[model samples]
Target: MNAKQIIVTKNSEEKEFYSEDKLRASLRSCGATNNQIDVIISQINAHIYNGITTNDIYKKAFSILKKFDRTFASRYSLKRALFELGPTGYPFERLISALLKEKGFKTKVGVVLQGHCVTHEVDVLAEKDGIAYAIECKFHSDSRATSNVKVPLYINSRFLDVQKHWNGNSNNGTHLKQGWLVTNTRFTKDAVDYGKCIGLTLLSWDYPKGNGIKTNIDSYGLYPVTALTTLTKKEKQQLITRDVILLKELYYNIQVLQNLNISANRIRQTKNEMGKLLHYDTFTNGTR
Candidate 1:
């Protein structure tokens, strides 16, 4: 059958004719060379069938990409890495707080703050320059999970409750600045519309086009440990459990690997990957 005639299924259960152009563009964006792109496209053509899932295609492409470079494979698998963050959202919440800290914001995770009506537990509360941002993190283990209008509506109401009391405060005039709804998945149109209608900042995997978490992580160069292709799923979980969420954290404290029983060679390999990702190890090159 012609590859163009193949129907592909998405995690959302949506079906469409497979587009080689789209797949090529995605791989190209991840720094796959033209030759590599040709190889993946040809393999995909040979591998795909009607009703094959997008997830299968992703895995196939990532398998090929990993053989080329772990860094590229890691970038290509970033979205899936996010899913690895959990069925439990605590690691994700701490991740958000860590990213906020990178931007010079003091952050607290799983904070309980008093609202005007009742108390509320914030996933992440970030403060910088007298501005406090309350963030609600919606994490989904399922790829198709999405935040709908109700999410923003719920957060807006809570923000109002907290904002009222915050503005009435007399302690150095520290007040709530913004309320944000962040998710590792996409947001429904209704969710995005309502969030903007009520002035709630929404961050999703690809929402706001280029300013979402995916773009932000690439821009900031602070990838999650889950994105390290050199690390196995179990190893990544171990690092996350040890509060070593970011590659920078792992790079700075290579000794933590000792506690995991990682071998000396494996430690060196892991450090090399982390150094490439975090721009470290110039001293070893005699360039420092």
Candidate 2:
């Protein structure tokens, strides 16, 4: 049976699944080797069934990839793992801010700045190289949801207001400010069009091709802590609630697990799994 004829997407949209060539292309983009991609595709093909959602396909592929190479699996799992960052998006915002920080931008999250029209609470305010950016992070728990035109419309308006009344900061010498809308999921066509038309930067999953959020995450090796399969959902939530957002943080601070009442054995397992997933020695050396 043809693969496309068998699968349905998570959106309940029926479409032909791509051939192995397309799947190989995707895995390659995530840094998977040719051999690993072939193995993964073979495994997925063996499990193919009618009406399998794309999400299920990805999960199965990621599970197999994890057993082979945890780092690649972690990178491949970036998109779906982002949903695990929140019941609320506080952790998501922090993760974005941290990513910006990695690029030499100083960041502050959840700041209330007074605009000419009204008070606006910015999700993230970043400054670097004499420029300031007012970033709005829209996070969706459901990977299927897209950030729509209304989001950029409202955010751009607020940025205009802030720009109008903005005072130059002598300390940073920042005379220019830009508005950026970032989401863990993809954006609607209308949203992307409006953002481009108005010069607002839109960053989302797989929209801008090479420079999308996934690329940035992979470039910086900043996989979220939630991407680790070793941790349970409750354990993940406990870490997120405490502001431990990145895998590096969790790896170095393994003692934090004790505070959550995780057993010594479980902590050891968590450390071992994280070491594999992140390709670092969680016990011998630290990332910092």
- What C-alpha lDDT do the candidate models reach, one value each? 0.86, 0.81
Q: State candidate 2's TM-score.
A: 0.89
Error of 2 at 213 (Å): 1.1
The alpha-carbon deviation from the true structure for residue 250 of candidate 2, after best TM-score superposition, in angstroms, is 1.7
Model 2: C-alpha RMSD to truth? Answer: 2.5
Error of 1 at 186 (Å): 1.0
Q: How far is candidate 1 from the true structure (C-alpha RMSD, Å)?
A: 1.9
Q: In model 2, which regions exceed 4 Å deviation?
A: 4-7, 12-14, 168-173, 276-284
Model 1 spans > 4 angstroms off: 282-288
Per-prediction TM-score to the true structure, in the order listed: 0.94, 0.89
Predicted structure with the largest lDDT when compared to the true one: 1
> Residue 48 in model 1: shift from native, Å?
1.9
Kindly report which residue pairs in candidate 1 clash with one another. none
